[model samples]
Target: MDDGRAVISVLLADDENLIRAALRTMLDLEPDIDVVAEASTGDEALSKARAFTPDIAVLDLQMPVLDGVEVAERLREHLPNCGVVIVTSHGRPGYLKRALSVGARGFLPKTTSASTLADVIRKVAAGGRFVDPEIAAEAISAGDSPLTPREADVLEHAAEGASVEEIARRVSLTPGTTRNYLSSAVSKLGAANRYEACVIARRFGWI
Candidate 1:
């Protein structure tokens, strides 16, 4: 706590140990910021956030079990007061767009400055929002995502190198239907194949 206000409690969630350690060290330097808990996976982050009820949850965009957007959605439902900050290397307009759409209060790239990171945390803790300038610019210029929901799902599964049969089984679609979805996604994304389509879509944060 500082200036007679409650200290901003934070939950740090990232898969990388070194990244978490570095963030903890940097955040601990701020007088009004306290990292109350840390998580190595999205599920663990959710559990810790629920248990600690931190003022801010700083999460990596990609994690095991659940991604940052999924965790953010769940957090908004279960702990609306807990602000979410997506800190990721992705930094694509689509990722930023999705995070904001899902009620995340902050979206920052991993390249963000330490001071800027702290400031964003303060802003979110005070009921404000922040988005990386580069991400915002890219998002505005990138316009809308081209893939439909079903196409996006197929592409997302394909990103894992899944066979068409495997994706069909997972999505409860016939193999031929799954192949059609992949073909549609590839054409929409202007890629030569499903693998390329998945790469492009993931890079744009569309999946």
Candidate 2:
């Protein structure tokens, strides 16, 4: 970093090897950027971060062992100086909100252009933040996730076509309690039934 120029050290973590290679290639083209490490899973990413102490970490939202939000939280605790950028195929408003809430410096979709990705890396490395404009707009219109933690768990099980009894067993709650949670979720989503509630919640990326 002290090599006579402002060099941004970066760590790239994605489940896909091709994506990591492409990103590294793109970042290598930037004069002030240096990809310090690469990982294919959240655990590997954390290990690499601990070893390399990169200035910025570009993470894919879906990864083995831990997801991007969890990794970001861990990094916030252990590597506070490393900026986080979450990139995902699902550009859901709720996901974006969660990323920002966990102190991620940037939230971008996988469809982002190479130039934009580099720009965001530089900005975050410099202590600034960025959010995908479309994601932000959707978050503004979608309001907040309506379902509580229990309601969301119930609805997610329902979405997978689980029966009320099965949901109760999985969540360690009685059938009556599970039904109540489902009913609450249905009312909050303004849906006619549990199935409809599941659809609505999934559409909003709440579960």
Candidate 3:
């Protein structure tokens, strides 16, 4: 602890070993912070949080088995005292909103400086919220998109040149249903064809 403050224990979760090692090295330099556990996947993070009783759990939003958002939801059920931080390379505008929605008090990007990272950890540990500045700006700029889930799904499949039959099979819908979704997406984007629908969706970070 620094200045007689309580020592803040942290749990680090990321898929990359080198990144974990680097973060540990940097955070260990602080007197009031202690990294109590590390996890390479969402499942491992949830389990370790139970065992370690960390003050904060810093996690990547993208992971195998269970995504970090699901893990955060579960963690809140299991470890109510621990804080949550969502850090990821993908800084999509929707992702920022989703992270906070899942009970994470903070959202950080991979490009964040070491000092800023440490500061976020400290602030979250002290019961404050943190969000990347760029993400905050983009979230407000993009505002709210009117695209629906089915539209986004159809656009993704269309971008890969998936036939309506194939998209229907992949999404558990009928060919007619897939076609309807694609047609609606085309109208929404003011696109002339499936290819143009995909292009505009990508432009707005919808797929």
Candidate 4:
């Protein structure tokens, strides 16, 4: 936890250079916060976090190499003391749940105001958690995902309009088993077909 007198160090990880620059500019203006490192990919973020050991990591939910939730999980395992904050344009219920499950201290949409973001950083640094109220409401109403982990993985592979053979190869399953999984996912999602299932799963961030 931050002691109020000490400046909280922060690491910013976003693929977009302009967004990162804007965040750095805004955060550096605060007296108690310092933007100590910047990374453009999840791999880079993890490397930089290890090198700098920043007090907080502000990560874009979607990034190259790995996503924010994956990075957060890794950080929780390796750098347990560093708090994670995930900011995304896609604030779907499942994404929020995954972020929280991975021990993210803060979750907010990219549209959050600079002042609000700064305050969230301070709060997280003080060993507190923050989730945008609107996002939290949606998460509560949307409820949990019905698909199991393997089903979700199959659906994600199916999302790109891949053939069952291709998806099976990618996921290392037999074409028959892959078909069964897809069928189960489609049935559970109540979709007419795999394509429809993909749409439903994506809307709920299940895949």
Model number with the top lDDT: 4
lDDT of 2: 0.87
> Per-residue alpha-carbon lDDT of model 3 for 91-153, expressed as tens digits?
766667666776889898877877888889889888899888888888777665455555666
**For model 1, how does the per-residue alpha-carbon lDDT over 1-207 read when each residue is reduced to its tens digit?**
347757899999998999999999999998889999999988999999999999999999877667788899899999999999999886656667678888999998999988999999999999899998888888787677887555777678888888889988765578998889889889988899888887888776677
- For every candidate, C-alpha RMSD to the true structure in Å: 5.1, 5.6, 5.4, 5.3
Residue 26 accuracy (lDDT) in model 4: 92
lDDT at 134, model 4: 93
TM-scores for candidates 1 onward, in order: 0.77, 0.76, 0.75, 0.78
- Which runs of model 3 end up more than 4 angstroms from their true locations? 145-197
lDDT of 2 by residue, 1-207 (tens): 345768999999998899999999998988889999999988999999999999999999877667788799899999999999999886766667777888999998999999999999989988999999988898887779977655776788898999999988776679998899999999998999999998888777677
Weakest ten-residue segment in model 1 by summed lDDT? 90-99
Model 1 alpha-carbon miss at residue 144, Å: 1.3
- After superposition, the stretches of candidate 1 with alpha carbons farther than 4 Å from their true spots are 147-184, 187-192, 195-207
Clashes of 1: 0
Clashes of each: 0, 0, 0, 0
Off by over 4 Å in 2: 1-4, 147-194, 202-207
